[model samples]
Target: MTRLDAYLNRIGIARPSELDAAGLLAVQAAHRQAIPFENIDVRLRQAIPTESQAVFDKLVTQRRGGFCFEHNRLLSDMLAAMGMANRVLLARVTFGDPPALPPLTHCLLLVTLPDGQRMIADGGFGGTYCPPLPLADGAEATSGDGARHRLTQIGAPGTLPGEWLLERMGPPETSDGRGRDHAAWEQQYAFELADTAPADLVMGSHFASTHPSARHVNCHVASRVLPDGFVSLLERQFSRYRAGHPVERREVADVAEYRDLLAREIGVDLPVETLDRLPLWAGAD
Candidate 1:
């Protein structure tokens, strides 16, 4: 088993164990606070590894945040080290301005406790960690913050019995047919228990990073959740979403300052070669 103290300390998870709801919340909070949700490595020529040691080296040893595969894989390993039984699953992410590429897939973790209880633990999701949703559908789960999120079964068996959906109830906002208002929330990601192997994500990750059509190739976006709301860093703007409030967007002027924030605030510092790619977005100004 991996050392729990080292793993928790690496991610700033101060809690003793993430076995219950409170502990789970602490783990999520620490994950968002410590590790960044970034695609910079993909932008760089750095190849994210699929093996456990390589993942640990890249994420824990190197102190970097990765996409779904890197984050969930490491998290799963950490849980295992903590003597927790867990499984890995894959999901096709449909985010804001969804990726146009074919294998724009995602990875998440499913953990089962000794009591036959199952919960979803995902520190990989950029800005949403409402709570640990039960593996069973039609189950309503609420985070410690009082945000109500639920999982509902989506597809039928003999096809994808593990298929499920998620939704959260938030504040109201002006609608634009993007599903509904801010209060209505939206479909986060659709996932199932199809038993996706780590090898599958490796191939997908390679394609995503190398393909010119991938979203990571076009722009830069880094997001991490906070106790209240969240903070996101886009091309030249930093947006903060506070609890019970709309998102606050700020334009960053200094090119040097933007790079500094990417390193300091985002926690995933890019190398010199990767830093040179910023000019591609100069026309946006």
Candidate 2:
């Protein structure tokens, strides 16, 4: 029998016996607090895992962060062991410049609770909420991270319809002695309720992590949400973004600081051999 207690303990899911909305929130909190969304394996030339056990061994045992494949796959397994029914949904993410990427590059999960209600459970997207969102159109999901996010329906249900967009209103940037106030709502990703296997995700994720043109392979930036601000490590500089304001950045002089930040904030550790190559991912040194 799959042990729910052990898995919950590993992920810090506290209140499994409660099995109510509160319990769901607890599970989501545990996941966000314990697991980190990261792409360190790409620098190490490690093979992205394809099984739930492999993900558990890499994350729980080895203490590492992973891309969507490993992160959500293990999370889904944990949820299933906890007696929750969930569906794996595929999404394409657009982050940096263009805004949204094409479909099939991201993965999310839809969870069905005992009350026959559906929620969005995601642990792989860095800096996202720990709890699932009510799978209802026009419902807003506010996270502990201070981001006001809502899901809007694009098309009719069962038509393989619209996107679940995550949006935020932030202060505008002031440059060259000019001040501007504006609102920005970008689509993180969109997906339908479809089941995706771990093995399948691994194959596609491998290409994205290794492809020379992919944004992830080209940038060494990693971020995690904090109560007061967000910590982002880009190359040697550590930046802090707070409540939609100018970022505070500092250059890291010692390499140990980089490793320590990964361990402390992002919940990851770099292998000894990969330490020298870390700068390669950061496009530094």
Candidate 3:
């Protein structure tokens, strides 16, 4: 079978009759639901490859998930194989307090529609919107999971000069208790239209996976976007988020439970030996 066929099968979605906006949204949503955003390889000390084939083997063949570099790279490859126009773009993560101005540490896809409009087709960002968002500044898009998102342009305009900030719109009530005001907009990440090369992605992946200060190095994180809510596994704790409802959380009792959670809920196939070697909930309280 062709790569496109393999990808379509991997995401459990039927082949689209046409590569229009509707088909793009369907494929993106299916991918997010099937594949999870995870850093298990980094935690296991396994080398994370940024090459397209390597990523495909791990994600599709092995049924494993990866961070942005691997996830977005594979998505771009699938889109190209299906005759879609796409480009790789880099982004700096600014999700935390006092937003981090780090180097381009995230990779995403910029897809061009037939009508010449650009859309951000990202399958890597955990718990974010699923459908492709229009790249136009101040345009809002909602995902199949009922989460709202938008993009705002920043800095001066030129050939990829200004950065685009992706913001997630929170719920109207303050019951979530995330310490933010009610109905606040959270900054997910910032990116530019500048061209991103494969080497650039490799560098970013290397640093993110191996750097001592990187959060992925110390924390084990896995997240999957579901139809009605989102599921996240951080260390040994698992949390579920549903729209207009309180976040539900619990801790895994032991290593077996953690492994079962990864395999059953996150669709990861980590070997038992690897799970035995790695620390499960070392630093978590």
Candidate 4:
């Protein structure tokens, strides 16, 4: 089957009848729902290959989910196959709220609509902002999952020129219950408008997958955006959020439950035995 056909079928969405905002939203949302944002292979200490054929084989033919590099690269290719104009841009992730800037390790797809509007698909951030938001300065959008996000152009981080900052509305206060007014808009990432070079993506993907301190190497993480909320697994903790509110949080009992939870809530299936490679599971009770 053609690449476009296979992609649409994998995501369980028919070809778009038109090339518009709604169409872009549907395509992106469906992709997020079907293909989870995950770091399973990294956790398993496997090599990460960003090449087209390798990514297509692992994420598509093998029916597995991957992180930003793999996810966005495949999405970019799929969009191109569907006659959509798009480019990949690397970004510095800010999910941890670090004191200083992080490396440019995330991949985001920027697409030009028929009307000249540029919509950005979140590199591999599932369960958070799934819809494509306009790349324009001060562009604010609420995703289908009801998560609020705003993108604004600003001076690039750490002595660079200009770049855009994407922020998501996070919880109201700090985890310690320190009083903070409204649920603040947390910085998600920052990226320049320029198209990322192929070599840069290769290096970035390597850093994210093989770096000793990278989150993927240290712990397990997977997320899937739901129709009305989000479901995610971080290390051993499993969480479900609804309408921006935390509804459930608990530790996964063991590897068996982890595998079942991924299939039950996220719609992504994997070999149960391979999951034992994770550090948490590698050790005996």
List RMSD in Å for every model shown. Answer: 3.9, 4.6, 3.1, 3.3
CA lDDT of each candidate? 0.65, 0.63, 0.76, 0.75
For candidate 4, the per-residue lDDT at 18 reads 83
* Tens-digit per-residue lDDT, 100-129, candidate 2: 445466777888888888888787775343
Answer with 2 or 4, whichever has the higher TM-score.
Answer: 4
Model 3, which residues run further than 4 Å from truth?
157-162, 171-182, 244-247, 281-285
- Tell me how many clashing residue pairs each candidate has: 2, 2, 0, 0
TM-score of each model, in listed order: 0.83, 0.81, 0.90, 0.90
lDDT for each residue of candidate 4 in 1-285, tens digit (9 for 90 to 100): 887788888889999888888888888888877888888888777898888889888878887888889988888888877767999888887765656667887889989887888888863764255468887888887765455778888875444423888877744221111113236777677888775778999999999898986667766778776666667887787877666565688889988899999888766687677776678776658
How would the candidate models be sorted by lDDT, starting from the highest?
Answer: 3, 4, 1, 2
Worst 10-residue lDDT window for candidate 1 reads 171-180
1-285, model 3: which lDDT tens digit per residue? 877788889999888778888878888888888988889889889899889889999888888888888988898988877767899998776665433456677878999977787898997875354468888889888754455777888865442323788877654221112224336678777888888777899899998899987768877888787766677787777777676578777888877888888888888877677787676746544
lDDT of 1 by residue, 95-129 (tens): 34354423436677788876668888787765355
User: Model 1, stretches more than 4 Å misplaced?
Assistant: 1-3, 15-18, 97-104, 142-147, 158-162, 171-180, 244-247, 270-274, 279-285
How many angstroms is residue 30 displaced in model 2 relative to the true structure, after the best TM-score fit?
Answer: 1.6
